[model samples]
Target chain A: MDRTAPLPLALLRGTATVLPRAVISAITAALLRGLLKTHPRLLENLTRLEPAIVHVIASDLPYRFAITVGRAPITLTVVDRIATGADAQVSASVATLVDLLEGRIDSDTLFFRRDLRIAGNTAVVVGLRNVLDREELSIANELEALCGPLGGTARRLARALEVIADSAGARLAAMHRTLHPPGTEAQDLTADVRRCHEEIAALTARLGTLESRRKRQADKIA
Target chain B: MSIRYLELVCPAGTPSALRTAVEAGADTVYCGFRDCTNARNYPGLNFDFDELCAGVTYAHARDCKVLVAINTFPRAGDESPWHRAVDHAAAAGVDAVILADLGVLDYATRCHPNLRRHLSVQASAANAPSIQFYRDHFDVRRVVLPRVLSVEAVAELIAETGIETEVFAFGSVGPMSEGRCYLSSYLTGLSPTSEGACAPASHVAYEEIDGRVLSRLGGVTLNCFARGEPAAYPTPCKGRYVTHGQASYLFEEPVGLNAIEILPQLKGAGVTALKIEGRQRSRAYVAEVVTTFRRALDALERCDEGTPTGQLHGNTEGGKETCGAYQKGWR
Candidate 1:
């Protein structure tokens, strides 16, 4: 069990480099189609946004995903060559993107931290974000559902990925700390802010704590 | 010492948010339809009728109540939408319908008299006479107070009105008269009262220039913040304007109102419920804020060391939280 293992992102980057582009596209397309099939309400909810193409770019990765919302037959496509003139573009690390989907992090908090950058039509972006937030999305649950019969294995693998992501977040925070050590009083303020960001990141990583919610309910019953 | 039982009413923009709030220990969850009939009528937010019915079922099974918000004013010629919303809410079996407009309230009173009605903060019913008007005419059971009233004022109103008083516990702090101010229409032709959104997203924009992010509404620059500085919704009231050769917040700064610390004072004030705003925000926001307040309220009930500390940071709109007018030490 190596703590600080940045596995998921590295694994995806490695697979992208080794696999043919067409094959990767086909796999992601199937997964996207499967997700839509399972979460029909999610697609219906997104249809309220004005018809537009939204680009989601993972700054650390070469690949980008573009989604068409509010139009008949919504589509999600993986692209390497960027398309121009998207209605809105949200660029962030894949981890942050996943957190946004899971609602592990509040988008406004991320905006305040500048961890996520959004460009283009503000209205479309706002609409898209609100629509996505409506769903109780879990990448692990989607994977399990996509793998019928082998769902347990998929669920276990998803848990492993989550563990790796949690540690990778800590490693990134370590790197950030190394880059900015405490200094003069003004710099100390910056350090304090950095610590707050780290705390928020830590809090976000531990968001799936259903045990406490249960405990609170139990306390009330008692 | 016995702590008064104060209900926690929370906002849920979507079906998922409603469930989240319920699971997070909200005594009651309030939501709106996906149309202009409600105040949080943003694109892609809120429930359709079917979703609302399902949400009500989900919440009732868990002993949590659901309230539908028909808080926005209906157009003069088009009262059907508002009227239809009340009918739909009644059909959905919601606990109550929170209303603002006089015409719509009258319709609910006459058409669906059995349905419980609550006065929305949008009505700006800050005084006993105004709240009593809704109570006597509409049979309103409760009134959600505006953020403008002080603790003393709230106690007085509760005593006079003799209605269930719901005060804001947490969320955005608005300075203008609720449900009445049209300062936003000056900037964007869409009426906040009619459209149900202040600075409708279509008219909102953000730009980065010279190391600052400028929030503009209807092409009018509202506030420019340095990189990493907290930004707020570019509504007219929250804007920073240039006056007297100095750039300052002309009306109010972009800050969030957090009254969790003052629950004791409110409970003593004979408040019935505390409402957490932000029906336009994410379900994550709902989960976090609801859970934090739930714990604080639970602790208050047991009279433990209060204020579930460190849980309230970085969870506000303007990136800052204030006690707001509830404890106006400056005033």
Candidate 2:
């Protein structure tokens, strides 16, 4: 993970850092259980990745997780550090990791944007990614199921917190833009360049259609 | 209204993706084994023997065919793995075995004479004589055309050779040379030909330095993207390197081949199958690409004229798509 990489989950990261280890353990256990229940082949598929221990680092938080892929029942434990050597390590912000787990954003897209970092045994990491990606997961669904009667309240609270965080992010961006007028102009130019690409694509498609039609007409004439 | 449109052959790296493609209207779903037997041999991706069997049953029940790609060349004196892949795929009752290796093709021809064989693009048989050689030698029922051919060239080759032709409809256009690319091997010591993966994700890394993202393969910097710019894969061919203190892509740019707009031309060019290439992609990608092409093909079957362009740009690499060489728009 890049030290200079800006992590946007400030409110969540602050909250997670202050939390006790016991609470983190409990939440981790429940989330793992939820994943197992939701994805039936989770254990079976992971067991194939024998001897590949995956170290997952939430770069913005104080916690890291070690998931032993080859172990039956799939042991994913939350620890303050990577206690043992790992075959592969994946590092990303808490927000990005959550979005990835819940299938909110595509993994390759994140990889292309350099938002997430993957290292070590290519096969092991790729296997872990594929196994996880095979399932359609949702943190909201897991939260709802993890808590019994308080599930609704938890969901609503989480939703409210997300809204608040987003609003804060937007306002911060606006303020930053107000302070930095040069960036705003650059952003506008980027938008214009994107529009040009779209225009070229549309024109290319139209021309290709006409070419195809002309070829068919040429065949008819022959 | 019995308009026979081209068959939609979709890629599935996993058994789950295979089922998704089948459900999403793929006429045929192609996949490789979990190892280096098939080209998309990425980590944690592809199907095991049992999974392949189940996938075959699932696709067969839905009238969707399954093609096993054992396309990678067998290493000298280490041919058993590739040979067994063909045997297993044949026993698994796959609709066909897509093969490119000459020795493996011969083995399949001699041992499993009943098995159907499709000439993989890895064969790089572009000309009519090359196609005829594969067809006559291995009894190849179809040939996946390389991405470099124009529609006229494709139509001419098909007319001359008279065999089933499959053209890439969407996916990353590997450096124009199909089977002979060793650029990744030069950098990573792992060959896509022998390993079935180009620029394997294991050897790839992305580093952020001074507010720019540097995509590297085998510790060699491939491409650097500015913030807010669409990024490309870290394959050797797409690298932007400096010669005279100015960096630019030498071989090709980082644009994906999108043949959706030119599907009508492809069909008219005597293309038998339209291959959507991305087995290593997630099921979400499989479903989305397959569904989009399915609708377009169905509409084409009904003589509807709307283009299937731009709808797939969301998932395309570099946020940009090209008609590839199908139109040769530059020429």
Candidate 3:
């Protein structure tokens, strides 16, 4: 169990890359179609904006997706190669994108943090962001709908797996910290000096109180 | 003792929000279609045709009135959408269609003669002559008064026009005349009057620079909030700018119009309805505001004095509230 266990990046990349491009594209198209069906305003808004090519790239993986808007029935496609001249290009980690789809993180905050990169046509990007923010989107719910009767069971199993993975990761990090300490001598010394100063202050305050009490007794005796 | 309860007009951004307002004791709930015909033409907001129909049915079942806001000004060549929205609203059996444009009102008057029309606040018909013109020409039954008018002025207008008047009781206070502000359009090339969205979400962006959050509309910085301070809607009018080496809210400060404590004064001013103005907000917000106002109105009807003031501090913009023009004279 190592804290420096490299985030299983290879495993994630392998899983993403092994999936067929057609399958991924089909899934994305189907999910977006379902979203439009539930929320028709999304398509209507896209139609309002000028026609543009938006390329969405997963920064941590070799995956790129493009959506062409400015027409009725917006289209989504998976591009095998990076787009060279997209009207707007949005790049983020797959996890961040998932969080966005789930409405778990604020897109503006991500953009501000530079975790979500947008280039080229900013108006289109802003339009897309606004449209997306107007609704509560959940990819898991769409997938569950596709699964029918087994959806509940699948969701429960997924939750259990997530819990197990989180606990396992936390335990591994704790063990790693025990093996390799923070090793900051200066910080420790600073803490010690701070404690000593606090003690001295307290003792001086106590001495003042004692002197006041002794002066009262002396005054009474005189 | 029989007391007339002030009609509580609330905003419903979605179907659920409409239902929430009704359940929370809204006398009337106003909403718009999912297009530029309404002032709150934000994405994923407002109702579609089916949703609007269902909402009307739902509100009717609950004995609550549904007002459809087709409040935006029609574009030069494209008046079809606004006309269709009025037709749809009438076809859906709404109690009233709130309108701002002159041409749209004429169309509504001619095509749907039986339908009720209310002049939208966007019309900014502050004076008696302007309001009388709408009532005389288009047969507008009600006029949602602009926030610019004082309570006394509102009472005077109502007395002069003898038409039903609705004043803003809660929500963002706009300094400029409604339906005429071009600040957003100047920066974004989209007209607030035509697009029905001021500071259209498509043109708004927020960035954190040196621990300060800067809210921009189409590349122009509108407002900057220090860390841990509450942020407001990114409208150009409420932006803080540098003037004479001092950065201050030049046009207007961010404060919500709250007439909760002055409910009696507004009711006394002969206001037919008190409008709560947050259609783009969530149902939770709708529920909270509607519920608080419902209680205050109930208490007022019971002849109780001293309405609560700080009940809505948390919900207000920048966590501050003011009676706005209603009490501006006192200051």
Arranged by DockQ, best first: 1, 2, 3
Q: Higher TM-score: candidate 1 or 2?
A: 1
Worst 10 residues of 2 chain B by lDDT: B305-314
Clashing pairs in 2: A122-B202, A126-B43, A127-B43, A127-B44
Q: Please report, in order, the local distance difference test score of every candidate based on alpha carbons.
A: 0.83, 0.83, 0.81
Model 3 agreement with the true structure over A122-179: per-residue lDDT tens digits = 5687667555655556666765566679967766665566667778889999999899
DockQ, computed on Cα atoms, for candidate 3: 0.08
Query: Model 3, B65-163: lDDT tens per residue?
Result: 999999999889999999999999999999999999999999999999999999999999999999999999999999998898788898899999999
Ranking by TM-score: 1, 2, 3
When 1 and 3 are scored with TM-score, the better candidate is: 1
In model 3, which residue pairs have backbone atoms overlapping below 3 Å? none
- In terms of TM-score, the best-performing candidate is 1
lDDT by residue for model 2 (B109-195), tens: 999999999999999999999999999999999999998889999999999999999999999865468989999999999989998
DockQ winner, 1 or 2: 1
Model 1 lDDT per residue over B1-331, tens place: 1223679999898888898999999999999988999988888888889999999999999888999999999998999999999999999999999999999999999999999999999999988888888899889999999998889889999999899989999987776899988888998899999999989988888777876888888999998888778777778988888889899987888788999888899999999899998898778888899999888888888888855744665878667888888888666
